[model samples]
Target: MNKKKIIANIVKVISWIFVLVFFYWAIKNNMLSHIYEEPDKFLRLLKQHVTIVFVSGLAAIFTAIPLGILLTRPKFRKGEWLFVNIANLGQTIPSLAILALAMGFLGIGIKAAIIALYVFSVLPILQNTIAGLDSVDKQTIDAARGMGFTPVQILWKIEMPQASFFIFAGIRTALVINIGTAALAYLIGGGGLGVWVFTGIQLFDNSFLLSGAIPITILAIAIDYLCRGLEYLVVPKGLRLARKTNG
Candidate 1:
């Protein structure tokens, strides 16, 4: 393997090790005692927060993919630039401000926080998905057309397959960022790891902070590795060969 791949692999290994160590340390330090103290409340809190995360993640994808598809297409697909700009502006909006704004209607909780993370996560996935689809070989697209493929077929069968790696890369980036941002949600009374972190700070409990921080970091690393595997799986063999040759 090349030097870049070797280094990437080493970093991945170290990341997982760090996660394991941090999680163990948090457990040993009794950072998780609060959950055990009130199992029902703890379970409810975790479930609610996880639901928010999943919903936010999906929201990001929904807002992202349509814009991505439009922007990546060769011709203007009706308000393409407008859609792209709107998504771009979503990213530009500060998360704190968004959360506060959401609080006006949604109240302070997972709903508001999910809106914040969803907004933050949308741009990268959208931009990368568009870029990835656009990056596909033009000749390959032409060949598909010559084979009598419709626009829809070209998109699903040809474009998406080629774009999978970049799309997944965007997802990987979004996941890592969301894991960290999930902590911020605690300020608005959203659950998840952020609850511990924020509560720890307020109560002068380092263990609570560590408990939150460690799990988040581990989740981020795990998602990153999983994305890498998907990237490997979806990246076209021809592209890999070309990369190898160029390297």
Candidate 2:
């Protein structure tokens, strides 16, 4: 195998090892027992929280896409730095603080958590999208113009197709972050996997924590791999060739 293949394999092995070790620690600590004892409650929490994740994920995507487009536009040159700084600031804010602030108005449950997670998740997707759009070559833009493509046509037919990989990469990151943060929703009674972890921590029930943590970690990994597959499908052939050549 080539050096790059070896490196990829090593990374995969390390990831698997990390996951397995964490799972073992949680299980040995009996983190999942509470949820196991009452299957019905566990199911209810899962149902309640899944909706929160979906809502939060959608909110982040909606906010990010438009902001990303606006930030990447040439006309908005002066505003770009300000927007990037604000997005970066969003990443720095503590999730707990965001949740606390939202709870006063939203009154707890998944709604508050959804708002917090959605807001926090936007930065990655937005930044990636802007960068991706900016990365498209100026020569390509000129060629598209020469070919009689309108601004919309150029964006949809040329730029967006090339930038798709970056956008999807951002989404993949957001999805994983969403899954992990969904657990924190339990703090406000949003009742997802975090309910198990939090309850287990409070009651010293290793089983409870393990049940929640294990499933979430697994789900995140599964979704990440699935998104990578989707990214491969969507990425343009030229980009793929370029990547291969660069490697």
Candidate 3:
């Protein structure tokens, strides 16, 4: 294996070990006592949290990917900057402020929080989609053109296949970011694990704090690994081999 692969495996091993140790410690110290006492509440919040993440993430993916494709077209290229800046606004503006604004327009609830998250996620995915499309080796496309491939065919069979990795990277990053930020959903009564986290802050209780915090951390890590695996599986093996060799 290459040095990068070795180092990555080592990191993964260490991460899993840390996760195991952390969970054991939490259980041993009774930090999870409250979670056990209210299993139903825990499950409900988990479902809400996962639902919020999944819905927002899916929306961002659909919106950004198509918009990115539209922006990359030759006719639309000049206007791409406008959309990029618009998307950047989502990132530049504070998430809490976005949520507040959403509350005014959409009202406070899961919908508001989901909109805030969708906005936050759009930038990275959109930027990456543009980037991934741009990264398709021009020479490769030129050769396809030489062979009589239509623009549409070249995009689906050439550009997209090659750009998959970078696009997935953006998705993975956004999802992980979403998982962490979802904790704030509680502030607006969106109902997620954040409830306990902020409540613990109000009451100054470690157990309550950990009950939410630990799960968020674990959820982020788990989602990241899942995305990473999906990236590997979805990207062509030839690309993986080429990347491995290049790395």
Candidate 4:
């Protein structure tokens, strides 16, 4: 009923319309001819790509969130800058270079790709978790302490809940980045949609290129929307209402 809601609805409608149109164009032009010719291969590659993204994302989340929390604690605060800079270095390097390094040390396969993706995907989640925890209201923390809540209790009950939205935002970003970067896995003999893309380029076939490219684009967009919905669902209702009102 509100202006923002109306605009969001309109944007959603247009996005679906665009996807539908693109799909129709691809089908009409036989852009997926290569995919249809070997459905099994396409399916296998799709599964591999999704698996890499999912596994690497989980790795990043588990590693980064705990490290971020630890860095915020008094005993670990001094090392925060060191860890943050190391994470930042991961992002600063080219993804292809990371994959190459993985290939050099870990060999050419899923193991190497997973290691590279995990490293590349970690920084955003780590940074966001730290920022989210840091942004929690000091007054709220003080009040919790006054109520005799233990440090752990305050973190679990107050800090994490307040920071959940920001944390999820970071995750969403990491997911999108992972989806895009996972394409490079094919270069290291880690099967993914990149196989089709590179093959298309090597063969000079537009159909092969679109076959891979379109699906990656769709997957990223779909996951992005899914994460956006999850963010709304998981964030406290009061916080959601406040955000809407403030916006």
Candidate 3's residue-wise lDDT over 1-247, tens digit each?
8778999999989998988998999899999777889999999998999988999999999999999998999999998999999999989999899889888999879999999999999999999999999999999999999999999999999999898998999999899999988999998889999999998899999899999898888899899989989999989999989987888
Best by TM-score: 3
**Order by lDDT, highest first:** 3, 4, 2, 1
lDDT of each: 0.79, 0.82, 0.92, 0.92
Q: Model 2: which ten-residue window has the lowest total lDDT?
A: 26-35
Candidate 1's residue-wise lDDT over 54-91, tens digit each?
A: 78888888878777887766686566667778877666
Q: Is candidate 2 or candidate 3 better by TM-score?
A: 3
Give all TM-scores, in the order shown.
Answer: 0.83, 0.89, 0.94, 0.92
Error of 4 at 124 (Å): 0.3
What is candidate 3's TM-score against the reference?
A: 0.94
- Better structure of 1 and 4 per TM-score: 4
| lDDT (10s digit) by residue, model 4, range 1-247 | 7888899999989998988998999999999997889899999999999999999999999999999999999899999999999999779999999999999999999889889999998999999999999999999999999999999999999998888888999999999999989999999999899999888999999999999988898899899999999998888899889877887
How many clashing pairs per prediction, in order?
0, 12, 0, 0
